[model samples]
Target: MENKMNRRGFFAAMGKFMGLAAVAPAVLGGVFSNQANAQEKRRSAGPGASAVAGSMVDVNDPIAKAVKYVEDFQKSPASKGNKCATCGFYAKKEMHGATEVGTCTIFAGKLVNANGFCASWNKKA
Candidate 1:
């Protein structure tokens, strides 16, 4: 009787292991495909586009001060034609007339004001 119980236990463990092995490939494949899709989106968005979400830059940051970044574009003298949305380094997507917040290449993935400008501003052609 004991021998029979041990055999049943062994078979149950084996079944579970087989099930996991079979599902692993599918799970891994999904992850890889999702990553590939994200990469393609970034590439299509142009040079400064990155797949990772970025943090908003602090106004007190040294770089911000050096670049003369202003949170509100209306407050800056150079805001006329150098807003982030119009800059060469801005990476964002606009949907349904709504502009998404974007990251700037100058800040190396840090989020910037869409209507903001910096010393590195290059007008988007």
Candidate 2:
């Protein structure tokens, strides 16, 4: 048999493509709209609101890796007596559930645990 897309097969493929194209905008819009609303709420809630519900920065996060961020200060021997809780780069600390989290100047829009340490750590005044 010849390896070819006959008229019927071509039409079927086109239909599938067209259907996905038609639905993509609505689906993508809803996803993006939810993110935008959440961001707006975070902004309105105050500068410190991020630690309340913001997503935690993963060790694998690009900036986190660049700064050698560690969730536990003890794991970072070079950090010596430094942690997000005492780092100048650390932003407001807040409780999310029972976990202690805060923001870092190096990782905006994300939260880091109080016990976390990073190369950017500076002694807080």
Model 1 worst lDDT run, 10 consecutive residues: 92-101
Model 1 alpha-carbon drift over 4 Å, by segment: 1-46, 50-53, 93-99
* Candidate that would win on lDDT: 2
Q: 49-71, model 1: which lDDT tens digit per residue?
A: 55554567787999999988887
Q: Which residue runs does candidate 2 get wrong by more than 4 Å?
A: 1-53
Model 1, residue 19: displacement in angstroms? 5.5
Q: Tell me the TM-score of each prediction against the true structure.
A: 0.57, 0.58
Model 2 lDDT tens row, 16-111: 999999999999999999999988767766675453447899999888899899999999899887889998877665687877887777787788
Give the worst 10-residue stretch by lDDT in candidate 2: 44-53
Cand. 1 Cα-lDDT: 0.77
